[model samples]
Target: ESLNKLMKNLYSTHPHFVRCIIPNEFKQPGEVDAHLVLHQLQCNGVLEGIRICRKGFPNRLVHSEFKQ
Candidate 1:
């Protein structure tokens, strides 16, 4: 109850939403699915949010190590 109240207060004062998308479900190393990524982005409205915000940049990285 206290945690929920804290979260509500935080959002009321400064709203923020985070959505994460995994590339694939096989847990393979060094694998990326462009279609899945794009679909997730679309579904999450990230691309639309970017256009709406128009002040931040999208970030991605290629990790050197991803042990699976």
Candidate 2:
């Protein structure tokens, strides 16, 4: 099922590439589904399953009170 796995991977990374099916009308979790994309090569084929990856936070912030 390479095609199925491939399709699954594409929808996981780049979510914007795919359109949402349920339109978020009910705003329910997992109620609807859509295609997602995976830009990073590291994430390839991981869409069929779960894999742990490094996490990072946004270092830049806007309109911060601490800003002078």
Candidate 3:
């Protein structure tokens, strides 16, 4: 019960800390759905097992990769 309440609170508070609201027109629903699926796959380590790999990095962290 306590864990459930904490999760509920986290979800409720998340939008307040969100930095930007991207326009839906600029982001296709299919593409966004695919990204969410990819992130889940990455978290589960499924991506590592695939023959073809895509380098995954958050937008801010991407700049650091280029600097090296």
Candidate 4:
């Protein structure tokens, strides 16, 4: 069946996740609700992950090094 093929393909690949957070209910540009954004990041563990990465690698990479 199609579902079986889909599951087989998914299991064979490395999946990456992208999380999109809404800044505000009004959907206005150049206007972000700090509290809402903070709540979303905290709930999603994004802040904690960033903190861990910073602690592990405190060195700042140059643009060329980063590009490589």
lDDT of each: 0.75, 0.44, 0.53, 0.83
TM-score (all chains, Cα) for each model: 0.54, 0.21, 0.27, 0.55
Model 3 residue pairs with clashes: none
Q: Give the distance in Å from residue 13's predicted Cα in candidate 3 to where it truly belongs.
A: 46
Which model scores highest in TM-score? 4
Query: What TM-score does candidate 1 reach?
Result: 0.54
Candidate ordering by lDDT (highest first): 4, 1, 3, 2
How well is each residue in 1-68 modelled by candidate 2, as lDDT tens digits?
A: 99999979975863323332343456677653333224322245443333333233212335663353
Clashing pairs in 4: none
lDDT of 1: 0.75
lDDT by residue for model 1 over 1-68, one digit each (tens)? Answer: 99999978875773447799888767577898888889999999988987866766533334653221
lDDT of 3 by residue, 1-68 (tens): 99999979976762312123332435765445556566666766665645344454312336766555
User: What is candidate 2's TM-score against the reference?
Assistant: 0.21
> Which residue runs of candidate 3 sit more than 4 Å off their true CA positions?
1-32, 52-68
Q: How many residue pairs clash per model?
A: 0, 7, 0, 0
Runs in model 2 with CA error above 4 Å?
15-68
Error of 3 at 33 (Å): 0.5
lDDT for model 3 comes to 0.53
